[model samples]
Target: MVSPVAVPGGAVLGSAFAWGHGVNLRRLKYFVKIVDIGSLTQAAEVLFIAQPALSQQLATLEGEVRQQLLVRTKRGVTPTEAGKVLYRHAQIILRQCEQARVDMEAAGEGLSGQVSVGLAPGTAASALSLPLLRTVRARHPGILLYLNENYGTTLSELIMNGRMDLAVLYGDKAIHGLSFLPLLKEPLFLVGPRAMPAPAQPVKLADLRDIELFLPRPYNVVRKLVDAAFVRAGMVPRVVAEIESAFTLTAAIADGLGATILPASMAREVVAACGAWQFQIVDPVIEAPLALCQSDHLPLSEPAQAVKSILLELVVDLAGTFAATPEPELAALS
Candidate 1:
């Protein structure tokens, strides 16, 4: 029987050499596959290995580090606390190794490396997705791409911790170890169901006080901006509920539960999805600044640099096509 162990604080229990020599890249990759597929059988089938052999390897991996990495239940396999930590670091290690191979193979070719990027959910769902992926595939097939869609704060934290090479997120207060490159200012819009009567003119920010609102929770950066704007306008918004998921928020608005504020791009998406109409918010013309951010503590890897350059170029080209107002300055916010 494999001995059961619990991880506390994610600290490695064994000595440095013990942890170092006991594990190999193959085992780490196998472990990650198992976690991703959520079943040893599925992972083995995908890896073209026997189930028993995969089980034995997992046992060996567990015994070497003397830590229980996965918890097997009737449903499937899930990573334990230690396994989660190992998985995150293993992803970085595997990518680095792949990058090294790509670099060697590229003797006289163009740039070859992996760039892991994090993007805010709204940004990821916008028109930028297709063009970004296509550009990378066409221009630099040697470079591997990994894209993660998350919230602004989550993306910022990932980039700062070295997990994500770059991210596009809303600029909040100054983050100490990251540099923010201003991208474009996104205007806020009020959305409601199509059946609702459209306002004759732009809805003033102060006028929002009369409308029942269903917005993201206070923890979200967008919600914070909305609340601050309301305070500045000297009116308290009638928030009916606090929702976190954008889809749920938009659906609620379409169902006539309450209206919500969203960036222009996101508002358009919801409008199309639920036959909703978006009204431009005016009076103060509130807008949020989107930025392309990266860690300032470390120099970007060659592949990361290449990806950044391509991304900047694509954003500029697309912004011009959309006639967007941009503040494209690579200024470090202190």
Candidate 2:
């Protein structure tokens, strides 16, 4: 990852401006990392550097931002109000540099090469990624696919290492070394065996306490939100088992192992297979935003750009069609 701090303090490509004294792109990036992990120690570990060096960078960033960016506490450090706003802006600035790299690479390649992509669980393989994937396959056959499922943080590391060319993932949680382009926001739905009875209309959040449920392991974004909903509803989930594979989890739900909370987009295909399991939008609703991600350090190959372009076009189409589809709680997103 190109650190924002790595740029010369006074370097200006287009405009004469002072970012900060002794500050560069890398430090600002470090600041963003601290905000995301909410801990100097964890961020340092991820960066694989000494804790003292990371802390020094944070101090430099805070001074440059001219505000108290983080609030220290027993658990971890959290960004202050101003800090949160700056983090978002920093992300935008960093992404522009990445896009520039993409553009430069695109200029020479003339659109014909391969890019292996890693799909974060729900992002690349569901109805959301299906159209984009199909379009890429049809329109850019030369591009090789190294499609695989992964967690958000894990995928980001792969992207950084150049193991994967790009990815589609949930965006609330930040991952370094990747640029996230917000595509569309989608909601989650409570899915259960159709053979099992359901309330007349959509069920309230509070109604799920006693129901036997099956859900993904805790790292899943949907699972986290589902757990939070249960907490808000003044109940705990009656989770009988947890599984990571969607095929296995859906199969379990279809076989009547238990009910599970899944994104509307992913639940769509499974519903047909569940024979008896039905799904409904839960009240006190939650929505997850999915985004397209690409490696910041590596220049995309020609075929990668073609596939990415087609995928982008497909994503635009899906976002429009998704708005009209009511059956699936989630709309297609890339």
What are the runs in model 2 whose C-alpha is more than 4 Å off?
1-110, 123-125, 128-130, 296-303, 320-334
**Distance (Å) between predicted and true CA of 160, model 2?**
2.1
lDDT, candidate 2, 115-138, per-residue tens: 666667754235545666676777
Query: Residue 298 error for model 1, in Å?
Result: 2.0
Q: Candidate 1's residue-wise lDDT over 28-49, tens digit each? A: 7899899989999999999999
Worst 10 residues of 2 by lDDT: 5-14
TM-score of 1: 0.69
lDDT of 1: 0.75
- What is the overall TM-score of model 2 with all chains considered together? 0.60
| Per-model CA lDDT versus the true structure | 0.75, 0.67
